[model samples]
Target: EDSIVPAAMYEPLVKAFGDAKNQVSLFKDIVLKLPRDNRATLLLMIDFIILVATNQGNQMDMSGMVTALSSCLLRPPRHLQERISAASNVFAIIMFFATNRGTFFAPEVSSLTQFLPPDDPALHQPYSNDKAEQPQQTQQTLQTLQTQQTQQPQQPQQSQPK
Candidate 1:
């Protein structure tokens, strides 16, 4: 039983992300001292969040995950504009999540998005696309919504008496 995924394996991650929601500064401090290798893993985690949201964009609440990633001190800000173009996929993702949830995380992701010099183009992007979608995914999403609606119980309407 213990050989399976361990609770300890996810505890710190949950804690870090949870804390990031309430106090971004604290989350920043915790990750600030982590070695470069750990920081690289953190980047993977950010990518994972984007991937999940893209795949399950309409099903779950990813605002917190996006917020945590934005809050963390991933990389120094400098190549932000360049990175955006390089990782167009990831760029579209965070943007998708931010777009659906309104401008809640825009200011934070933009303000926190920055990287140091010497890196040709690291990664990042958001917004600017009013219409960004793949035909297959859009079709699948619509079908799923239709199925869900049919499965739910319809509410009864009340009548008013004159």
Candidate 2:
């Protein structure tokens, strides 16, 4: 309920507790100091703010929420940086689309990158289906490994001498 419920509630109460104005003091003061697993839960709370503020037509300024998220992603214990960056990317896309319904895209665009952050370089690049899944190296490597596994001939197992 943290995400979905708060997503609904923040529409009316943003003036009081909006992260933009509060600068997400609660998250900085309490959540960031918590352990990794705990931070995950609290990070999600901000996502609720993003999703709600956008989808609810609440017209709230998201700068504080964005700043809080960037800190969460860019702060230390660098181990979690990648995961945080990824989650923040998801949060950015959701917020962008929810706020701007269609300046350059509609659901019919069917291209996921159309919803990327305003500053993403990929936004300037031309999109094509071939470039959609560019991280093919890993999948190709896995396929090669599977083919090798299937093609190799197996030798009869030798019983160990007692």
Question: Cα deviation of 109 in candidate 2 (Å)?
Answer: 28
| TM-score of each candidate structure, all chains considered together | 0.26, 0.22
The regions of model 2 sitting more than 4 angstroms off are: 1-27, 56-141, 144-162
lDDT for each of the candidates?
0.42, 0.45
Q: Which 10-residue window of candidate 2 scores lowest in summed lDDT?
A: 1-10
- TM-score, candidate 2, is 0.22
Residue-pair clashes per candidate: 6, 0
User: Candidate 1: misplaced stretches above 4 Å?
Assistant: 1-22, 56-162
* Candidate 2 per-residue C-alpha lDDT over 2-64 given as tens digits, one digit per residue, 9 for 90 to 100: 222122322332232335565344323332244443334433444455565566566554654
